[model samples]
Target: MKTILLKSGYSIPVMGLGTWLMNGRECFDSVLMALENGYRHIDTANAYENEDDIGQAIQTSGINRKELFLTSKVWYQKLRFKDVIDQCHSSLEKLRTDYLDLLLIHWPNKFIPMNETFKAFEKLVEEHLVRSIGVSNFTINHLEEALKSTVLPIAVNQVEFHPFLFQKELYQYCKEKQIVIIAYSPLARGKVFESDLLQKIGQNKDTGPGQVALAWLIKKGLVVIPKSSSEEHIIANLGALSITLSDQESSMIDNISENQRFINPSWSEFDA
Candidate 1:
C-alpha cells in the first residue's frame, strides 16, 4: 500500500476501503474482507452508521490497532463545539479505538461558525483523541475560511473526485496549501463502467474501467477510498496500484468531456 505524508506529520495509506451505505452483516463481511486483503486503511463516518460493524471487523481480524488507519467524520448538523467533542468521543467508543487516525467535518455547515468547530478539533488533537483533522465536501471559499479559523494544519480535504467530475481549481488550491486530497466516490458511483474511453484504457492496461479510474486519481497524487461490497471488485480495485498510465493516457482522461457531479443534496451549498 502506497502512503502519503500528511501535513500533520502522519502517513496515510493512499488506498482505503470506503464503508458508505453499508451496514449489518454485509458491512462486517466487506470490512473483514478488505482487511484480510491488502488494505490497511478504513473510512467510515457518524452518518454512515457502521462504525460498530467496522470495529467488530477489526477485532475479528486481530490486526494491531497501530497497524490500521481509521478515518471518520462528524455530521454537519453536529458542528457545535460541545457536539463536535461529544461526537468524536462517541465515534471512538463505537469504533472501539482510543484515537482516530484522521477526523473530518463531513460537510460544511454555513450556519455553524468554523472557529467553534475547529476549537473542538484542536482540543481533540491536544488530548490525543485525533491525530489529524480535515474537512470534506468543502469548496475553495469554505477552505479559505477554515484555514483562517484554526492554527492547526488542515491535513486533508476529502471530496467527490473522479475523471468525469475533476475539480481542477479546488485541487490546485489544496496543493498550494499542502493539504492532501482524498478522492471519495473515485469510481463515479459505478459510472466508470459506462465510459467508452475508460473501457478502452482498461482494455489496453488489461484491467477494467474501475482500475483505470483509480489509477488516474493515484497518478495525480490523490488518495482514493472506493467503496465495494463484492469481494472480487474489492480485490480488483487494489490492482490499480500496479497500473502505470502514460502521459497521453492520463491526458486523455483529463480531456474527458463529462463534468457530472452525482452526490449533490438539497442542503449542499455547492454553488455558494
Candidate 2:
C-alpha cells in the first residue's frame, strides 16, 4: 500500500477499509481479511457500534499494532469538552487500544461550541490517547473555528468525495492548509460503478469500475476508504493502489462531476 505522511510525521496508508453499516461476524471477518491483505488502515466510528468486533479482528490478525493506522470518530452528541474525552475513552476501550492513530469529530453540531470540542482534542493529543486529531464533514469555516482553539495541527478531514461530489473548494482549502482529505465514499456508494466513462476506463485498464474510481482518487493524491465484505472485493480494492490513471482518463472523470452526494442525513444541512 502507498502511504501519505501526516503532520505528526507518521504515514497513513493511502487506501483503507471503511466499517460503516458493518457489524458482528460480518464486520470481524471483513476487517481480518483486509488486515491480512496488506491493508494497514481502518476507519470506524463510535456511532458505528462495532468497535469490539474490530478490536477482535486486529488482535487475531497477528499484525503488529505499530503497523496499523486505526481511526474512529466521536458522535455529534458528544461535542462537549468533557464528553469528548469520555466518548473517546469508550472507543479506546472497545477497540482495546490505548492510543488511536487518528480521531475525528463526526459532524458539526451547533449546540456544542467547536472551540470547546477542539480543546478536548488537544488534551487527547497531549495525553497521547490519540496520535493525531481532525474532523469530518467540516467546511472551511468549521476548520477555521477548530484552528482557533488549538495549536495542534489538524491532520485530515474525512468527507464524501467521489467524482460526482468532488468538493473542489474544500479540497483546495485542505491542500493549501497541508491537511490531508480522506474520501469515505470514494466509490460513491457503488454509484460510480454504473458510469459509462468508468466502465470504459476500467476495460482499458483491465480492472473494474470500482478500481477505476479508486485509482482516480489516488491519482489526485487523495486518501480513500472503500468498504467491502467480500474477500475478492477487498483484494480488488487494494489492487487500485497499483493502477495509475492517465491525464486524459482523469480529465474524463473530472468532466463527469455533478456535485452529487449519497450520504447526507437529516442532521446535516449538506444538500447536493
Candidate 3:
C-alpha cells in the first residue's frame, strides 16, 4: 500500500476503507475483507455509529495494531475539550485499540472554541493517544483558523472530492500548508457512473468508472477512502493503485463542469 507522511511524521496509507452507512454484520465483513486484502488504512467516525462493529472486525482480523493506520473522528457537537477526549477514548475502546494513528475533528463547529478543541488534541498527541490530528469537512477558512490557533500541526483535511465536486482552491491551499487532502466520496456515491469523462478514461485505461475516479485523485497525491461491502468491489477498488492518469487526462478531469456535492449535511460548512 502507498503511504503519505503527515507533517507530524506519521505515515498513512493512501487508500482506506470508509465506513459510512455501513452497519451491523455488513460493516464488520467489509472491514475484514479490506484488511485481508492488504488494505492498511481504515476510516471511521463516532457519528457513523458503527464503531462497535468495526471494533469487532478489527479484533478478529488478527492484524497487528502497528500494521494498520486507523483513523476515527469526534463528532462536531463533541468539539468541547472534555467531549473530544471522551469521544476518542470511546472510539479507542470500540475500535479495540490502545491508540489511533489519526484522530480528526469530524466537522467544524463554530459554537465551540477552536482553542479548546485543539488544546485537547495537543494533549492527546503529547500523551500518545493519537499519533496525528486533523479535521474533516473543513473549508479553507476553517483551516486557516485552525492553523493559526493550534500549537500542533494540522495534518489532514478530509472532504467530499470527486470529478463532480473538484475543489481546486481547497486542494491548492492544503498542498501549500503541507496538509494531506483525503478525498471521501471519491466515487461520488456511484455518481462516477454518470460521468462521461471518467467512463471514457476507464475505457481507455481498460478499467471501470469507479477505478478511474479513484485513480484520478491518487495521481494527484491525495488519499481516498471508497467504501464497499463486497469483497469483489473491495479488491477492484484497490486496482486503482496501479492505474495512472496522464497529464491530458488529469486536466480533462479537472475541467469537469459540475460542482455538486453529494453529502451536504445542514451543519456542513462547505461554503464557508
lDDT for each candidate structure:
0.95, 0.90, 0.91
Q: Where's the lowest-lDDT run of ten residues in candidate 1? A: 263-272
Give the Å error, residue 105, model 1: 0.4
Candidate 3: misplaced stretches above 4 Å?
Answer: 269-272
How would you encode candidate 2's per-residue C-alpha lDDT over 63-102 as one tens digit per residue?
A: 8888999999999888898899999999999888999999
Each prediction's Cα RMSD?
Answer: 1.0, 1.5, 1.3
- Predicted candidate 3 versus true structure: per-residue lDDT over 178-254, tens digit per residue: 99999999998988988888888999989998998898899988999999999999999999999988999989998
In model 2, the number of clashes is 0
Candidate order by lDDT, decreasing, is: 1, 3, 2
Worst 10 residues of 2 by lDDT: 263-272
Tell me the TM-score of model 3.
0.97
Q: Using alpha carbons, what is the TM-score of model 1? A: 0.98
> Candidate 1 at residue 49, lDDT?
94
